[model samples]
Target: MNWLGWLHDFFTDPAHRSGPDSVLNRLLEHLAFSAEALALAALIALPLGLLIGYWGRGMFLVTALTGVARALPTLGLVTLTVLLAGVGDAAVLVPLTALAVPPLLVAAAEGVRGTDPDTRDAARGIGLTHPQTLFQVCVPAALPTLLAGFRTAAVQVIATATVAAYVGQGGLGRYVIDGLATRNFATTAGGALLVVLLAVAVQLLFSLLIRYASPRGARTGLVDDPAGSPALLKESV
Candidate 1:
């Protein structure tokens, strides 16, 4: 059969549409795995980034370490994780979370660190505490960069989550791996297409977020109106 014919069969195949191993189930599994890894990466990277950025300390070191982490091979990390932890979610999570951290950590640190010094001073002059200044001023200003990092990490994780199938975990990658192993061109194409579509959807979602969270957007009252922080500070005082 031609490539189109295989895709048609792959899509029409009732076996691919239902049951535990169905496309729908595997797609959900892929999303779940990506979400878990992204969450873990954010949980580890965000607070640490914020604290260091706020203090202007260790940001360089952290970014350097995560940069090295980014250079490590994802499949190698997964294999090592599997060997040590045994095959399960941990094997998938360890590598993907590591894959996700560099961008997130760097973006978080730089975003917060890049906050306008004048804005910080004004916030402090208005009697805002350090924590308040960080949250209300730095965080709001950092939204664009932070969201971009999240979007990048999210797309990377979704694309790489297929490795889950390598360790006997269920995900859309299963179709690709199984298809290639069995020389089922239709399944491989169909599975790859689904992943691309998913990554595109995430990219669009984050684009909307970054646009609206931007300073220009906030000035236009698009987001929470972070541009009006001075007025809010006066009100608080």
Candidate 2:
């Protein structure tokens, strides 16, 4: 059948539409896989990133690791992981975590490095402990950049999670793979569309979350409000 006919059949076919292995189930499975992978990756990468960035030590090793991580292709990593860890969900998590680390680590390092020296000195002068300075001061300052990195990682994980289906893990990608196996163009196209939609939705959610968590100053880009004075009053009034 032609593309249009296939799409019509896909939507209208009762047999295809009414089952446990339907499109909706596959999409939900895909979302679950992506979310779990991203959450796990964030839990692992974020703390390590914060430590490496905030403490200003281990920068070299962290950078090197992140660089190596970035260089590894998702497919290749997944292949190796499957060989070592065997198939199933474990195979998916290994590569997804690897995919997530670089952006998180870089963001963290940059966030810590970008923190103003004066602010650090001021915190130190107040006799704040290193951990206090890190959590209370440096992290707050670096939040915007860090959030940007987090968003990047989230999007990356979602896109790559489809690979899990290739190894017999259930996801929307099953549609695409199954379609190819059976020469069903509609399933493949529909699956690809679903993956794109999933990525966009995840990205939007994360962007909103970052904005909600960001400091007012970071969101507004005005570190401090202008002083009230006659000249300023004249300009406004």
Candidate 3:
């Protein structure tokens, strides 16, 4: 089939359309796997990162360990996990979670560490407790950077989740693998394109969510004015 006809068929073929076990269904499943793994990793990594980065304790050790985790190749890690856990989603989950942790940890830690000392001191000066300072002052300040880390982890997981098919877990990767087995280039290309589109959509959605959740001052890069301070135009006049 010509490229244009292939595109039309991909979109219009009733069997290929969104349904149980359809391309869209597989894409959603892949996304679900990515989300669940990353969410679990975030729950674990975020608090640990906050403690290490904000308190400046065990930062070195945690950072070092995460670096080592990140250094392990995704394929190698997945293979090892399959060897131990046996094939299926468990095998894929182990490696994707491992791949996700490093970015989350590093971003959270760096975000906390990167908070301005003056701002932190000001929060302390207000008689806030250590936890309050970390949560209210430091975390809000570092949200953008932390979100960037999340974006990175999310995209990586989505792309890598396709590897699940190699271990007998069905995903969009099934189409690719099956295509290759039957020498069907069209199916392989279609599946690959769907994966790419899904990844892009997820990235864009998360980026927008991060921006929306960021504080107005942070999003605009404007410093907070003290109460009773004149408005900028009034002060200028």
Over the stretch 1-237, how does candidate 3's per-residue lDDT look in tens digits?
776666665566676775665877887778778988898889888999888889877878776868797788878877888888777677888888887887788778877987889999999999999999999999988776677678778888888888877887778887777778887767777777888887898778766766665665556442221111211211110
Q: What is the C-alpha local distance difference test score of candidate 3?
A: 0.76
Q: Is candidate 1 or candidate 2 better by TM-score?
A: 1
Identify the candidate with maximal TM-score.
1
Judging by TM-score, tell me the better candidate of 2 and 3. 3
Per-model lDDT: 0.84, 0.74, 0.76
User: After aligning candidate 2 to the native by TM-score, how far in Å is the CA of 89 from where it should be?
Assistant: 0.9
Best by lDDT: 1
Q: Compose the digit string of candidate 1's lDDT tens values, residues 111-191.
A: 888888999999999999999999999998988778878888899999999999899998999989999999988989899
Which portions of model 1 miss their true places by more than 4 Å?
Answer: 217-237
Error of 3 at 9 (Å): 3.5
**Which of the predicted structures, 1 or 3, would earn the higher lDDT when compared with the native?**
1
Clashes of 1: 0
Clashing pairs in 3: none
For model 1, name the residue pairs that clash.
Answer: none
